[model samples]
Target: MDQIKARTIEIFLPTGDSKEVSQAIITNESIKIIYISKSEIENQKKRISKIQGCYILVGKDDDGSDLAYIGQTEDFFQRLNLHKKEKEFWDGVYVIQNSSDSFDQAHLNFLEKLMIQEAKKVKNYKLENVKDGNNFSISESKENECYLYFSTIKTLLKTLGFDLFVPNVEEFEINEENKFYFKEKNNNFSGEAIFENDKLIVLKNSIVSNEENVKDNYIQYLKFRNKLINEGVIQKNNENLIFIKDYPFNSPSVAAGVISLKSKNGWEVWKNIEGESLDKKYRQK
Candidate 1:
């Protein structure tokens, strides 16, 4: 019986004339499990002309509960039946019923990414392997043209510590009730993260800035900046700081904490030229 079942599993996914996909087979008398992605399910449904991708969440946890596995397959019924035949824990997936009749899986993919990213910030999930981000390859010039005009508004609101999670980034402008500033293509991405109730811009999102690391604190930087200005290694021209010498500091926090009791944008605080700050001058023209 086991040999026959293994043979069935082997013949499931077809090859493109010669490219075979692999599957995990359990030989032990105890238990074994295999996983498949939701994309695979979505693809299968389209090929067969049917709706797919829904879950029957049997339970929940204190923080976020689920004994069920998130999965995707082309033939939901066939896949579930196959799992029941092979897996020891048949209840998990076999019992689930499809609930998502109108969900756009492509959009759901975005939500899944956001959920995983935010979940890692929680204390219990601190060990999650999700990497810290907002890398340089993200082009600022393209931000205006590629997205729904107010698309990043929630991210801006989230940074400002406001409550704003509407999922769709496009609806904010069309709806007047959104109240937030709908600053279409016009924005100040590189200067001070000027906090306005209407326009919430990322301080680090500025093209002029070095894309701040995730864990940096705006308040802490302020305190650190104040301490540096007092110590004298870095002074100010007007609102910005000026460096009198080569500053050997790293992050804003570190540069703020160490540099001669007086730190500025170390980029601006350390320099060979009089009144020139490394922070601003170091950038290529």
Candidate 2:
């Protein structure tokens, strides 16, 4: 059977607000994901307290970087109550449970360990788990079942805007057709970017001009540039700033603006090897 088969998902918004308490399930699948905001815990306790499952606490750090804490428990409400008092950083939780209460302690342990390992591999969020959970023995058949459950968990988490298991840029295939370049000889500005998955990715090692060259009136972009530098996403090397890792920007214009240190219509400035503007190639149709 093909591994990538189309599947349907159903989401229920208990509070009418997508951000409050939401439940998601794949069609015909027993695994369920409940996203509960810190503020909604009081309202959801009666429904979720007795659930046995693995959960992830999601939040942001002081610098606004994403943070996550993965755990499993026999009673969801009880575990969350402890976190409410002890873990101040998390503002929401995603609980993964079986609809029929089919999972035992062994199953939860296995899933928790698997999730922590994958989250660490992605490095998309700062993990609060100091140690991966203990290994548990399970039947080979049950182990295979756990893998399938994990796959669904990953999908639901991403659907909720948490790309916890998404692959890093280095893992992406570099399609030459999707690649674009921005360069200006006089200012020592040069950058390589790729338009993929609806976002522009500025490849690592790309050179950027000094902040002084940025348009004075574009305060937002200037602050963004400063934040990237402060966060070590980009660093000064000799006479130029260089990206330490591939970074994704919402648009070609934003990527071009940051690279050139000036306001520019990214569509017009980003070009292919043959010097075709991104606008002409992608937006002209």
lDDT of 2 by residue, 1-285 (tens): 665698889989989998998888998889999999998988898878888999999998777778899999989999999999999999999989999889988789899999999987766677889999996688998899999899999888778776888765766788777678898767777889887777888988998767664446776576777877866678999988898778889888888877776788998988988899888987898
- The model with the greatest lDDT is 2
lDDT per residue (tens digit) for residues 1-285 in model 1:
575434211212232311121122223211111222322433333232343432221222332312233343444556655554654322322111123343344433333344334433321111222343223333444343223212332332233222223221222332222211111134211122211232322221112211223234354554444443444434554443544322222353244333223223434433322343333434545
Name model 2 segments beyond 4 Å from true.
1-4, 135-139, 168-173, 186-189, 208-245, 260-262
lDDT of each: 0.31, 0.85
- The C-alpha TM-scores of every prediction are 0.20, 0.81
lDDT of residue 220 for candidate 1:
53
Can you tell me which runs of candidate 1 are displaced by over 4 Å? 1-50, 56-66, 90-101, 111-285
| Clash tally for model 1 | 17
